[model samples]
Target: MQHDFLKNYKHKTKESRRLYSRAVKVFPGGVSHNIRYFEPYPFFVSGAKGKQLSDVDGNKYTDYWMGHWALILGHSPKVVVNALAEQAKNGILYGTVNGVSVELAETIKKLMPRAEMMRFSSTGSEATMYAIRLARARTGRRIVAKAIGGWHGFNTALMQTVNYPFEEEEGLGLVQDEGQFVESIPFNNLDASLKVLETVKDDLACIIIEPVLGGAGCVPPIDGYLQGLEEFAKKNGSLFILDEIVTGFRLSLHGAASIYGLEPDLFTLGKIAGGGMPIGILCGDKDIMSLADPVARADKESLCAIGGGTFSANPMTMTAGLLTLNFLKENKQQVYSKIDRLGRMARKGLTKLFAESGIPCQVTGEGSMFLTHFSKNVVMDATDIANSNRELLKAYHLALMANHGIFFLPTKMAALSFAHEEGDIKKLLEATKKIIIDSKLFKRFA
Candidate 1:
């Protein structure tokens, strides 16, 4: 069955195969980002509009991956494209301070007041790296505690335990000592996490975490879990940093921090905040954020040393982001209501469908993000996800792409944007049913 699907995928993606053949010569694995590569070569997208991606092969797909789950308004929303087109006429990158950047920041602050003071950067990795650095600088401590499978990004300092086989090093080129100052805690297990935090409390600079475990799995926090960590960090004199790069504007207009009632000393924002453009925002309390202020510090040692890169606050991103935020702000009730409804529909529908077919699986998610784990056991953490039938899940996602026109970036969570509708969710459920009935892939796990 897998062979048949692979053949079908290969048949449809011949042009993509040719392009990937050339891409391998230029890129490390014929793809820029690692996850973009899949079991068979990934189909190269030619264009995207609304909830669909048009591939080079002339095949169209309902793109649930949604630009790494960024495009909350979906691809090329006319409002953003129109603004960007005019902004492009003016300039793409200013390499200096600009008014649009200030408006964008003000817009963010208006929506998320916790962004009392913020700095723009080119990527979420930089924002998170700077976040921890600011924590250490502020508290005069070296230790950073993150959940065992919490993915903060590829930055060196926080690259402690991102993947399964949590004890092993992430990869070569990252030294062991680089992670000596970092500690791993169990997510959703407050008591155990607190026990881990107790040992390093004295020297702990911060406890950085994602409200919803994004990349490790779409595992939402159990009750009191996040609050417990926040209290611990506060009492231990450690900064509680929320890495909301994936959750910031995606989860809510204010962010997951607001949803959880968290007062993070520092938090990182990306994805939907950028409105499909490249951006990362480090935002927090003004007193703590002031550590990175260059004018006030006046000396290198006094400053925390974080800044927006060359492309940071570029006019294009600023324009798109500002417009997107404004759109969301004006129509937030409608936007979130629709997407969240669709998300719940997908989760409930999929769970029921799998159960009716005698397939034991668990769907984990919150709001508009979700991932399916082929396990009868309750999936509460990354270890549970790792133990689940991942190959089957991957095959299911692959079959969706090959036999159906739905795209999931194989094995990654799916996000419903404002562009996604009830019809799209119905389509997804129907296609999933067809795949399960046609392929009988779930029987292996059953």
Candidate 2:
């Protein structure tokens, strides 16, 4: 079955293979982004609309990746696209302040009361980096505490313990001793998290975490885990930073912080907030955010120096974001309920399918995001995921893409957008069932 699937994949994606052959000479690993690369070669997407992605090879897939989990409203929503088109005619970038940026900021503030003051950056990584810098500057500390397997961004301070084995450094050219400044605590383990925070309390500036572990398989925190972390941070004289890059708008209109009743000292947001454009936002209390205020600072060195990129808060992204947020605000109840229902349906259906096939599986996550684990043990943290049958999970992901026409992050997580419907969910379940039966996956697991 595996061999046959490979043959079919190769035949269907011959054009993609040809493109990759050219791409390899230009980009490392034949892909601009590492995650886009997969075994054999990843198909080149020609277009995306609603929940469907059309590949260059003429195969259409039900896309669950959703622009790396950024497009909650799905691709090319009319409002966002129209706003972008209009904004493009006026100007893309002014290299100065704009009304659209102010409008977007006001909208975000209305939704997130904790964001008393906010600033923009070009990408999630920059937002997280600025948040860390602000925390350090405000608290007069250098150390940060992060959850084990939590992914904040690619920034040096928060890059440790992300998908890599605990205590193992994951990237190259990291600033020396930067890893020392980051202490990892087991996610959802209140006692262990407290102990780690206490150990580094003296120098700990903040505890940064994702309310729902994003790239580490959508593991939501155990009940009260976020609240406990916030309390611990305050008790230890450290700030609490919520990295809502993935959960800010996708989880709810107000974000995970609001849903969980978490009042972090700082919050980093990206993804869906940009309305499918490149954006990052850092928002927090006025006292903490004042460090980034250029007018208040007498000199450049006096403030934290949260520099902006040339493209940060450009008119195009601002317009798109404003339109997206306005739509979400207007239809909050309907949008949230539909996506939540879809997510629940996917989880329940997938769980039943796996069980009926005699496969050891666990479905985890909340709201519109989820992940599949090829394991019997309950997954509460990253280590549990690391210990699962990863090869089997990879095989399953490949099978889904090659045979089932479903596309998500390779064996990582799946997201449901407002564009996903009952029909799409039904197709996913049916395809999964067919894969389980035809690939003999049930027998192998048994």
lDDT of 2: 0.88
Q: On a 0 to 1 TM-score scale, where does candidate 2 land against the true structure? A: 0.98
Cα error, residue 70 of model 1, in Å, equals: 0.5
Q: Give each model a TM-score.
A: 0.99, 0.98
Tens-digit per-residue lDDT, 1-446, candidate 2: 35566677888999999999999999999987778888778899999999989999999888999998988899999999987888788888899999889999989999999989899988999999999899999889999888889887777778888875777768678775878888999999999888778888999999889999888878998888999999988887889999999998888888898889999989999988899999999999999899888888969787888856999998888888889899999989989999999999999999999988778889998999988898889999999999888777777777788887888767778888889999988988898888887875556675
Clashes per model (N, Cα, C within 3 A): 0, 0
Those runs of model 2 whose alpha carbons end farther than 4 Å from true positions after fitting are: none
lDDT per residue as tens, model 1, 1-446: 45578889999999999999999999999988889999889999999999999999999999999999999999999999999999899988889999998999999898888889999998899999999999999999999999989998889998888898999999999988988999999999999999999998899999999999989989999989999999999988899999999998888999998899888888999888788899999999899899888999989989999978889999998888899999999999999999889999999999999999989998989999998999989999989998998888888898889888899988899998888889998988999899888876776677
Superposition TM-score, candidate 1 onto the true structure = 0.99
